[model samples]
Target: MGFWDFLKPRSKEHVEACWPGGKMLQVHMEYDTEKTIFTYFGRFGLTFNISKSQLTGAIVKEISRTHSVLQVYSGVDCVGTTDILPTEACNIMKDWLGQY
Candidate 1:
């Protein structure tokens, strides 16, 4: 399965009860060579990273406990130049959010 598949939207009633104008995001990381999705509440200043995978990225929106997926934006490969790669998008998200 691809990433961002583990998260599910929360109930409408619950979302309506919370603050308005808040965005949502979900994240999934590889652990023991297996993917593990984890939901977290985040605003515009959250980030996380993984050294082994050499990934990084930031939360572009607010998320809820029901969020458990991530939409890749940018990333980099451990080999070759240090330039950002699509693979490192997840890492960038985590680093900016300090979720490492």
Candidate 2:
């Protein structure tokens, strides 16, 4: 690997959620080290390379012990929101992305 590549932090891939196509969501913790920012990066629909962001643009919340809230957005607008299991977060994100 190149020097710069060696310096870069490795990313963890979430294969459970596949989108836009062959790409899976990737999470990088404290990616830059300098900024110490955790980032989620993935592509959407082939043409767009979404960054800092996953399946990063998606938000999951726990409203109850048995149910979680899944929220997806397109830009500033919230595209979809529904209560779901925590395990369903990625799957729900895929569905919203497909529809919106």
Every candidate's lDDT:
0.32, 0.40
Which candidate's TM-score is highest?
Answer: 2
Judge candidate 1 at residue 29 and give its lDDT: 30
Question: Over the stretch 1-100, how does candidate 2's per-residue lDDT look in tens digits?
Answer: 3435546775534322233222333311113333333223322211122333332355666676655655555577554454334435445554544432
Which regions of candidate 2 deviate over 4 angstroms? 1-56, 86-100
Residues 23-92, model 1: lDDT tens digits? 3323223222233222232333243433333444433332433332343323642221211223444344
- RMSD in angstroms between candidate 2 and the native structure over all alpha carbons: 11.9
Q: What TM-score fits each model?
A: 0.19, 0.29
Report clash pairs, candidate 2.
40-53, 53-56
